[model samples]
Target: MGSEVHECHLVCGPPAAGKTRYARVLADRLGACLLDSDQVTERLVRAGLLLAGRDPDDRDSVAYKEAYREPVYETLFELAREHLPRGPVIIVGPFTREGGEPDGLAGLEGKVGQNVIAHFVWCDPDERKRRIEMRGETRDLPKLADWDGYLTSCREDRPCWPHRFVDTT
Candidate 1:
């Protein structure tokens, strides 16, 4: 906080984990640029579908993932790199650290060194489910429908590498 002209703040967790909400507040408090991977993915998916001439109401479809997952994450990384040199950047996403998927911040870490801080948002299962239902976001219908599977994917209390935990509930 003393001499950091710029830094990286990552707010990460599974769906409905209050990542975007908490990250918004944190970004404002820290004067950091807030970037949400989901929002970026949404825009990418929409444009991809439009360009491909494939219309689908479901945002969770495999088609979207196939078309945009890596690209979206890479784009977010690009955006982060651009902002990091100027000021703090807060990226919100499920940037899982220990999973089979590659860490989204891997490139950034190699670039920025110790200036990056990651915060994982955790919510009680019931509270998360209630929040999911309340929001009723179309992108989450699959997760809500397969709640048990969603829980299975998040069995790790320490899901990823070294990071602070923020219990949103």
Candidate 2:
């Protein structure tokens, strides 16, 4: 995969699935550009431009997700478009919902017409719960209280894109 030129590798999974850590290692190993939603959103929030909710800093809020999630995803993919031509890129995020198919990558494929590799990270439910709790972020709602129901919500997920899967724990 390293020898492949101008590739875009999208590393996807739910929050706390270890996609960020895995992609960080992979990007360094491959010397690829890494574009991540959390990093980008953090920047936006720091800039005081991404409140999207009643609580300006509460990511767990529905209004925040409604306003920022897709926009963040779009920004990361656009950043990938700029970097991918020179080398490979790893974009890490929960870009897709827990139980949904991968859509066209913000329509980046047709525009760039380049190879876009995809991989999804998976972790054991118990371990994932532990990790999320350890992180203790504001975004862990919905899952923090009812992990079993969250699991059910994502039970039917199957990505439309053909890809590989990695177990993070």
Best by lDDT: 1
Q: Best candidate per TM-score, number?
A: 1
Error of 1 at 146 (Å): 2.7
Q: What is the overall TM-score of model 2 with all chains considered together?
A: 0.77
Residue 65 error for model 1, in Å?
3.5
List of clashing residue pairs for candidate 1: none
Write candidate 1's Cα lDDT for 1-169 as tens digits. Answer: 3454587877777778799999889988989888898776676676678889775334455686577666776777788877776788887777554322346345447644535687878888888989989997766777788888777866436444667889988
lDDT of 1: 0.72
Question: Which parts of model 1 are misplaced by more than 4 Å?
Answer: 1-5, 49-63, 97-108, 111-114
Model 1 weakest lDDT span, ten residues long: 96-105
Per-residue lDDT over 1-169 for candidate 2, one digit per residue giving the tens place of the 0 to 100 score: 2344577887877667798899999899999988887887686753453343354445544666776777777787678777776788887777566225455553445544566677888787788889989988765765777778777654324356676788877
Taking all chains together, each candidate's TM-score versus the true structure is 0.79, 0.77
Which 10 consecutive residues of model 2 have the lowest summed lDDT? 46-55
lDDT of each: 0.72, 0.70
lDDT of 2: 0.70
